[model samples]
Target: MNTVFVVGSLNIDQTIRVPSFPRAGETIRGSDATFSPGGKGANQAVAASRAGAAVRLVGRVGQDAHGAAILQVLAESNIDSSHVKLTDSASTGTAVIAVDDQGENQIILSPGANAALSFADVDAGLATLTPNDVLVLQLEIPRDIVRHAARAAKLCGAFVILNAAPSPLEIEGLFDDIDLLVVNEQEIQDLARLANASGDLAELTETLPSVLGPAVLCTAGAQGAVTFLGRRPVHISAPEVSVADTTAAGDTFVGYLAASLAADRELPAAMAIAGRAASIAVTRPGAVESIPWRHELPTLQDHDTQSAALFLSHP
Candidate 1:
């Protein structure tokens, strides 16, 4: 099996359940605080591993209790953390999250040690990837380092998969190195603005690959995801489920997609599996805690097989 290498951030998520999001300058009381191992990089790495992929995570954390706890969680998830760097200069990255009864969440991030992940770390991480391996990345770390890692992965003949989270104003040369670009609805709008293109989801989905890469996966919560493979857009419907917490839904999708691809599943099958896994994720709480294991997923035997076949046939 091809390995999934994640070059991204590791954060200790401090979450609280609230009646609703606090207004600006308003002090709102909430439920007791809870801590979890999260961050786009760690979440996706854990998700991929849980989805039955061999995942290696590369990033930085402080030499603090939070860092140790994060490492322990990764170990428990069966992710290789050997490349994870521990720094004394800064504390572990953190996200302050507030989730309401409606499962909507508001987050504030403090990069901390995550901002310190250097190109050297990226180089070491990319060294482990071989041709056909999946190299996953996010924007939580330094954009320059992300660019360098993407370029390096491309040079090594690895498949570069970038989840353009917290989308930036100018990606510059990074798009050239990405083989698969994953984005949510808001992220697609941000990218569209950056490219000076139409903000319409369908138009962006159709035209993004021409400017960005060969494929773009645009995820619209509840509405499912649309994958622009060349000029054709393949839509995958997300299963309907009551959402408990949506913190890790996107990460779960990205992770399962990478895992399915690494396992050599076709794009349609991979999307179906990923969508199902993400549907399961939103029904639970926390980041890594919410991601479903491979055994926990429903067997997509007859019905989903036909659906995937039909989608592929049409596209």
Candidate 2:
């Protein structure tokens, strides 16, 4: 089986359920506070492992309770953490998230140990990769490290998937070495500088492929996703479900997509499977904890472009 390698961050998310987000410098009362294992890299690694992939996660964590806790969490999800390092210099990455009644969220992040990850760290991780494996990466770590990992993975003939998050200033050069680039609406709009987009939804779909290259998959929450594979777009909509927390929906989608691809599934088929997996994820709470296993998706039909488009548009 093809191994799925995730080179990214591991964070402990502190979430609060509030009536609404607080305005600048305003303190608002929240109902509850919860701590969960999060971080885009760790979330994706956990999700992929839960979805039956041979997953490996490479990142740094603090030598503290949060980092120790994350190791146990990843082990429970069946993810290989042999390369997950623990450093005493910094705390593990932390995120403060506020969720509203409608399931919308606002988040603030501290890179922490995630920022200390260096190219040398990734290079050591890459030493374990072989051809035909899938390498999944995110922007939560250093940008130069991400670029180096992509370059090295491409040279080794591994499929490189870059999930562009927390939007960077430029993305054109970044796409040249990537086999796939996944982005949410807001990320695409900001990275591509789509002026005509009235909102996150429009901005991404309209200008994502232009600056981010042709092999782009843009995720629209509830609305499903759209993929441009050097041709006309393939749109897939998600099934509607009562959302509890959308913290790791996109990460789940990416993880499932990587799993499916590693299993030799084609693009459309993989994406259909991924979308269904993600739909189930949003209906629950927590990040990695919400991802479903591959065997649980019996109800999802395989590769229905039309139905997928509907899910992308409506749910």
RMSD values for the candidates in order, in angstroms, are: 3.0, 2.7
Model 1 lDDT-worst window of ten:
306-315
Instruction: Write the residue-wise lDDT of candidate 2 on 1-315 in tens digits.
Output: 789999998999998889888888999999778898899999999878877889999999999999999999999888889889989999999999888888777888999999988888888887978887999999898888888889999899999999988787765466767888888877876765633333345335545556555477888876678775554567675787898878888999999999989988887778888888888888787777788888877566544454334533442
Candidate of highest TM-score: 1
Off by over 4 Å in 2: 194-210, 307-315
lDDT of 1 by residue, 78-167 (tens): 999999999999999999999999998988999999998988887887787889799999999999988898889889898889999978
lDDT of 1: 0.88
Instruction: Compute the lDDT of residue 77 as modeled in candidate 2.
Output: 88
Each model's total of backbone clashes? 0, 10
- How does each model score on TM-score? 0.94, 0.91
User: lDDT of all predictions, in order shown?
Assistant: 0.88, 0.82
